[model samples]
Target chain A: MCTVCGCGEGDTKLEGQSIHQLPPHAFIRGAGGHHHHAHTHSHAPGMTQARMVQIEQDILGKNNQYAARNRQWFADRAILALNLVSSPGSGKTTLLTETLTRLQGNVPMAVVEGDQQTSNDADRIRATGVPALQINTGKGCHLDAHMVGHALESLPIDNGGILFIENVGNLVCPAAFDLGEAHKVVILSVTEGEDKPIKYPDMFHAANLMILNKIDLLPYLRFDVAKCEEYARRVNPNIQILHVSATSGEGMEGWLNWLQQQRP
Target chain B: MHEMSLCEGVLQVLEDEAKRQNFTKVKSVWLEIGTMSGVEIEAMRFCFDAVVGNSLADGAKLEIIEIPAEAWCLNCAQSVAVKQRFDACPVCGSYQLQVIRGDEMRIKELEVE
Candidate 1:
């Protein structure tokens, strides 16, 4: 299911791949090039000179530009975009469903679901009576800003609304791609290892907040809440941690309050 | 792997540079990959070959310059070398390390004709 390179996940039918590939016509390309110093040497007669061109550029430079545009779009519309990242089965969709159900009539909300192959998550969000769009990464591992920029075209959103971008379930790749969200919220379930923050430090480091989901099962499991929080803080000193069970709605008020506070 | 997408990004830069800098062929590429950049060097190398095939950098040599991860330890008030994201400050054993450098993946230079 690795859409980043399309290897190893095995289920690569890519049903939504072709649909998402439509050119983002509204995207404006900025003039791009760095101040490069090219050193040339003509070694032989009638031979092409071998030159070293100094092209100092970030590899994710293009993606960053798109993310910047997306950021601008969100800012202009006063949209509270939250990029939710986590490993598979971390109950991200469950949390979103619960959050949407609670805030249905109060606030305007939209969702962008990222998965490798299916529109199932988007279906769940739409079932909640919220506008939802699905972005299947195909063999891709993460959702880049370009895909999101395109998704924004079809999504019906109101000003100052919450747009939750549920990133493809991966701790490794999604951390690297920015989708123009205000904050990255990494979800870690108690069913998973408590040391996941350390094991996947890149993700924990990138996230501004960490939601320790499925906390209602704490009574049945040996998961240590304090230890997990400590480990998360080790990688990300300023990361705010929240404990919640999307299924049982435990500690959801704090989660909702936090969401409300993030709104512009 | 994301390394594959990273390789695609490298190829894209090369293509863009080719059009701007008036280079039809790329001979070699020098990449600066930081240790804390979360990129596997071997994976990058493996994907690079597959990505640049039949492109402007079809036969280009790939050279990666590994950058060591360094962070500013607030506890010790000095820069410290770090190997991982969870590494504590060597002197004070504190986790309050603000990364100052070494989380980059950049195209540093290119040998073109």
Candidate 2:
């Protein structure tokens, strides 16, 4: 039997049950379909009486382990790490560029940009005179803790500084992997459907805050600001929200002030 | 969409167990997937089968036990069944809730030889 959880029926129990389910930093997606069953088929011929090896392990255990180590590294340096996530065309890069430009000399900052291809986003961040590391995931859709840990070497962030990790332009896959950030800020543009929170509940619930971007266009668009906030709150009650437009610089003060307060 | 990566994670765990527990081949794998975990069973199985080809877990049966999410309603101070992350409290219809269970993907048990 396994010593920790007493899980196996075999004489030799595999040790280490690193299975843990945290409240959510938003990661790896595997949802839908209500099929639930205990499946057991016939074993391979001549190999009878399969021993039930009790090995209770979390699927995300390895990623979480790497995340924990990265978290410790950040903690030791007193760095405020933030993960920014959103769907494609959410103006995340624009907002990031505008924010970095405004807070350039006020705070020491660095960025790690994640994408499936190209170093375009990192190059955009570099335009603002900030150190940016581009992690081209190639075939991968999400940036896990292990990749972020390796990216740390490339992006030399100073102590007491802030590091923003811009995840791939995906709302689903990125929600399941923790990148060892102090907070996960999800940016949702007003142009998107108000029911986005309901459609992507896991991401909304995992995020510490939701940035309602492109508010300047709200006047031209029919987006209901109240309804959008209401929908977000329905999914995650404790999530803090802010409205801003990187283009027009509307509500940029609140965004900047929020970052300052989080500085270690 | 990330079901492939999640499936790969499962494979890694299986390979580790094979090395540590002296199992040469795996016959079956049991996974406990939470409803609120956002993992689709069909996609997970597809990815599992595709990746297991030529590996130690080739032809292994994938068993999934769907776990229902549970949360504590702050308004009514009751534990309610949550099928999804956005599910409101069944009692008071309040959104304020503290999730107590689910949001997990654990390898519960395995059949090996």
Candidate 3:
């Protein structure tokens, strides 16, 4: 069972259900009286013409609208919202917990966690005494702007503070979504392939910064740090790369410094 | 699937336009999807069929116009056609290609009544 949205397993219903009724249609008998043809027309006179409507609009326009609203909301409150995205098992939760633990009392921070199921990540965040809200996407692969806006209602964020939105453990779908974040920080573990940036070029191109985690395991694995940076730069010329190990606390200071610099 | 939510977004636009333009039903929808948009055409069609059910656009035909991805080769200093995001320049065989076009996902027009 999902905790945040109260959605249970095996449930496939869509949210915000709306009742719709079919428009009036008249079935007219044919001249031979052997067939019936359905005719649908407008009730108002002279308004039944089928015409082409010029609607040149983006398919993600609605989500962008919600994202813009969230952006304005953050701007008004002086909140620096960072969206942390990475593949599953890249150690995002670990990094977040460590960051929160290190910056405790020095910064007023709140976390919004996203996952396909389970609130274990949020629970982990709360264990560090930081406020966290979990958004179980259920069958959703990523969180949209509308969902994040709703989550913000229950999450009490501090002014002039940071709001870390840990996105679902997916690379493709999340790249196309904008949850009103100031910057997208993509994490790449040293345990994974160095060519991940090129493999998932869309995610790498969309992200402003790429955090290479699990540097402590570099000696144990054949993950090429330089190759990874080169691939990321090829995808995005201006992407900032950081090497960090949440487990060993290596490069945490630089990560923390980057976060502090983003604040207003 | 993200395609499901994208179909839902299209429905929202149709419904909003119905109120603003005084149209009760939609007959067809034309979408301009770029090759580099990362949206699978078959997946989008399936999601559209499922999402438009019981709505004003129920049974509405979806017509997709695929926009080919375009990029500028820094080595050749000319615009070139490419398939994927990481595609090297076709002219100079350089990986320094900067994407200039494509990645559009838009509803260009609609047939409604």
RMSD of 2: 9.4
Which ranking of candidates, highest TM-score first?
A: 1, 3, 2
For each candidate, C-alpha RMSD in Å?
6.6, 9.4, 6.7
**Per-residue lDDT tens digits of candidate 1, residues A173-216?**
99999899999999999999999999999999999999999999
lDDT tens per residue, model 3, A1-264? 223333222212112211112221111111332322234545566557788999999999977987998999899999999999999999999999999999989998999998877779999999999999887776678877877876787788789889999999998899999999999999999988999998889999999999999999998898888888988988887899899999999999999999999897
CA shift at A167, candidate 3, in angstroms? 0.5
Candidate 1 C-alpha error for residue A142, in Å: 0.9
- For candidate 1, write residues B3-109 as lDDT tens digits: 97788778778878989998888989999999999999998887777667656776578999999999999988999999999999988999999998889899999
- lDDT of candidate model 2 versus the reference: 0.81
> Could you tell me which 10 consecutive residues in candidate 3 chain B have the lowest summed lDDT?
B49-58
- What tier of docking accuracy does candidate 2 attain? acceptable
Clashing pairs in 3: none
Candidate 3 chain A worst ten-residue window by lDDT: A18-27
Question: Can you write out model 2's per-residue Cα lDDT over A66-163, one digit (the tens) per residue?
Answer: 79989998999999999999999999999999999998897889998888777788889999999988877656788888767767755778898899
Please compute the TM-score of chain B alone for each predicted structure, in the order given: 0.98, 0.95, 0.96
- Candidate 1's docking class is acceptable
